[model samples]
Target: MRRAFVQAILALFLVEAHPAFAEGPLHVDITQGVASPLLLAIPDISSGAIPEVANGEDAGVALAKVVRADLGSTGFYRFVSVDGHYAAADEVAFAPFARAGAQALVVGRVRLVGNNVLAYDCALYDVFGAHLETSQRILVAAPQWRRAAHKCADMVFAFTTGDPGHFDTRLLVVGQDGERPGLHTRLLSMDYDGANQTVLSQGQELVAMPRYAPGSRKIVFLSFVMLVPQLVLADLDSGQITALKIPPGVPSAPRFSPDGRSIIFSLARDGVADILVIDLQTGGVRQLTNTAGSNTSPGYSPDGAFVVFESDRSGDPQLYVMASDGSGQKRISFGAGAHASPMWSPRGDLIAFTLVENRRLRIGVMKPDGSKERILSDGERDEDPSWAPSGRALMFQRTAAGKALPGVWMTDLSGKLESRINIDPSASEPAWSGRRP
Candidate 1:
């Protein structure tokens, strides 16, 4: 019976999204398996007498590489090597690209605009249809050449997928290094692809669960100072830290509300944990869950109508959902494992969590009512699953059985592709930011 149950669970671990029948732009059916990835061609950017930027390198080539990397990382496109260069405004030869089995082609040109600014003109073409799909001209400071590339890629992604691209977002994570006796933990921020990493906090204090506010530059995290955990708010622009005054309790698993007006977290007192919310403007506290067991990791639904959290009230650490006001509390997870660290998707369609069974940790997602549970990743130790802003992907930490350091990884909703982020100092607990304004 136990073997049958395990087999049943594995059978339903993933459900692919059906391909849309009606479509204008090319949309990759991530829920279904692609027999062949879409073929794309991106030639090296063409330019004339372009001055080098900070690194004294060809800005044109650098921009092209960034664009190519961004598009290729999606797993939907397979680049076809191109030897010839074409200017951004040149007429595309559709016959060669189509004969080469390329469905899409990207061409662009980089030129110096002024003493410190550059202009990037990019164009995308449908090789088979022999027509231009879209084009854009982006102006940026020479130092921000990557941003221009990202914007260009975003244009291509949006035009192709009919969805907003997440290329311009950032990620907030906790960097951990050193041995156990002298471990160091600090707050770190970087691009979504793990570039331009900047330490936001000194290693003097231990920080965890760094969360970014929706549509804001502020991040709220739990910091341990002098062996006491406190909630701190850090401003990315001003580099200021402020301690939030909460009720007399130890706070953990802090997250910003959907509107960013309040914060919901788990507070422990007298060996009992409960969910609590505090108004950011008025600093008023309200207890949401008053249960005997430990209830933590509260995540709000997209509309802020419901919250899902983890608790041991049912004898094991399972998932539970309740009303925003702490009403209608009920268990949602009922599989053969313990579920923890539940986070509601930004689209409010699914809840992502860490599942532990047979002493192996995995990342899983399920419906709000916890009916269609499906494990997305398998690793020796994978925990703290956070959703992408578009709700199509998740970022988590994975540590091998014998490895002491944990690296950050991302997996899409389809569970077809998993890639480790290239960051230093061993990162964990990644919190993906929404699109920046």
Candidate 2:
């Protein structure tokens, strides 16, 4: 029963909008940053035909709330007050929402089909335009009704912002439990909004720097045994873990290739560390860097044609880019501070990294050629930037000056609208996963 619940089934189908209304030009331009959140009127979804139980309430009401919360968190849409909301029934009266100053409106219905199966239908409308933009129907297991809501929110987001939605994605973070003497560091997994958390590690050993494969259920991370770092691969669905075979060295910052066929990491042996890649299929190892100084934290460009890493070959640690096979090594960061933990954005437009200056670490981004560098966080200590699947925002670890532990915080590309992920116990090193299959 538990296994069946864990493997909850979900299906999505597009539904035709109302014939009377047509699609209109109502969109939120996110490229330039949303100056003001678009006001939306979202009423409780109606229970149509059958009243199903989900999330301790009628599936209609609960799912509507989840959808509203998901859109609100992105700092893109603001929910109209309950007093200003009208019944989101099959027939929507757009005049009321428009009079309430709502630019957009959402309406939905939930019904139960066979045993423990739910069908959620949601529609998005432009209140001012008085037209239906899109609608979708999601069928899911009762326990997985929340996924339906997330999918609905994603549909609305994509229609409004012209970008892929990231609400259905997951995040892997390093969670610390207990204090320094007997601290238990475990690899944790949760939804993008910090829900349905699960411990991926046994908490027996310290886990750090977890990264998800581009579009798979596997992850690679670093684990310490007896204070020695070891590269580990984990199958999230199977709960199986195995140590990766590599050259004799201490491995750190393991990241998957865009194709998920190989992994790139930094291997430290003797007195120096260099970036290396291991082919997961044939178990062949290749070194990408042999510079004078240490090179580490390597990430791949979206096309897998270039690699970005941090190296101190020129003195302070700065970002460098080279061909995927280790040729054409060149410095990309020429700023005043040192850069590390460089991660390429999914859209292939920017590279996010950690900039260390004046004894403080901050999260920043730069173009592929290392142009238009801009800091996105004002926290005292912000580092370990992981780009969102959409490449429009980033998640990083933030620690206040007087704090002992760091928490995960997210910021948009504009450096405005920052929020801390509401998860208990300090967490760090967040890796955002792509959309779930």
Candidate 3:
């Protein structure tokens, strides 16, 4: 068997906070300048004690692919496709990476353990001769063997940048399957790669805007059971469902406050549309916005004391922020017409929203103080921007030529679209969970 021991007590957990591996601020102007992304070169294990998942598949291929995929999705790191000179691992020099315009390289060795157990040892090097970083040995149980390779990839990501790691998290989305027109709506949750998709709900009715609770073990969404939209909460472990205490008519966009004690949503009360907040324990509803115009698409701040919502009080749909008690209301958006669907970043520093620019819609993020606005994407219609749990990546719905086509597109803080992560067309309103932050 492999060595069974604990050193520094940090090896027992998958992640440990260290300033030596933090993601610092990027000083470049993200709104205007479109610059080149840093090139990344990821090589496979050189031999030794390989991870357990490397038994059947090529160790180098499996580990290298994982690292490539994780880094590629960030929209920041570009993987360099170097074909030749991989055979001569020992004689590999810095010229190839330099010629390919690569800035960083990750190399590792996989040590094979007895029977079912394995260990992984990896090292990250800065091609510009800036720094050389290493990782502790990765010991894995047989069932969780694949996670060992993912751990090494995560360490490489944290070392190269000064931000918290997000490669090990999961994504829950609403996948629409079946033929056109008469389609079937079922809830699909999967890993970040769209694999291991598990159906959460299946039926004839429609489900929209599935959001993960603060802790991520539970989910809250809007469901139309009998032509009435009700706020429903489901537990992932027990598959049990509970109906929230909401009034009659349609109540959509259910978002949990920062403290997770109350939920703010939009209700079509009587005839006019308004935003309301419900106390989780007492089921008491407090109307937040009483504007005569339609009010919808509500979000909460990270501190649980303030909220940012959308309304047409300014003669056009725009974003607004207010206290938890519905006092001291202030406007945060000054963009062109139809600036709705504002989702507050969990980091409490930025807000991601949608706007109409040049008769087309695009996704953008700005400071909560209404400054430094930058559009990240452009299309015929791109609306409903959702933030990743880490607040580093933003996912939204995209439509071209107006056919009700919706696909998920992710981008980083620097406005780079890494991978398209496409799903079946007609998928819309994606909200990533807030757990892994």
Task: Give the alpha-carbon lDDT of every model.
Answer: 0.80, 0.82, 0.67
Question: For residues 336-356, could you state the per-residue lDDT of candidate 2 as single tens digits?
Answer: 899989999999989999999
In order of appearance, the predictions have TM-scores of 0.89, 0.91, 0.80
Residue-by-residue lDDT tens digits, candidate 3, 1-437: 00111111112223323335624221112233335555778765444224445466766567667767776776656677565534314645666776776677776555455565555555565666645544545665533444555566667665655444566555666666654422677666655555434567765787777777786557788887787777988777666778898777678888887777778888886766778998887889898877777778888888777888888876888888888788887988886666778888877778999987667888989888778888888677787888875577787877666565566667777765635665654466676765332
Q: Model 3: how far is 332 from its true place, Å?
A: 1.9
Q: Is candidate 2 or 3 superior in TM-score?
A: 2
Candidates by TM-score, descending order: 2, 1, 3
Ranking by lDDT: 2, 1, 3
RMSD of each: 9.7, 3.3, 6.1
Per-residue lDDT value at 238 in model 1: 63
Q: Regarding TM-score, does 1 or 2 come out ahead? A: 2
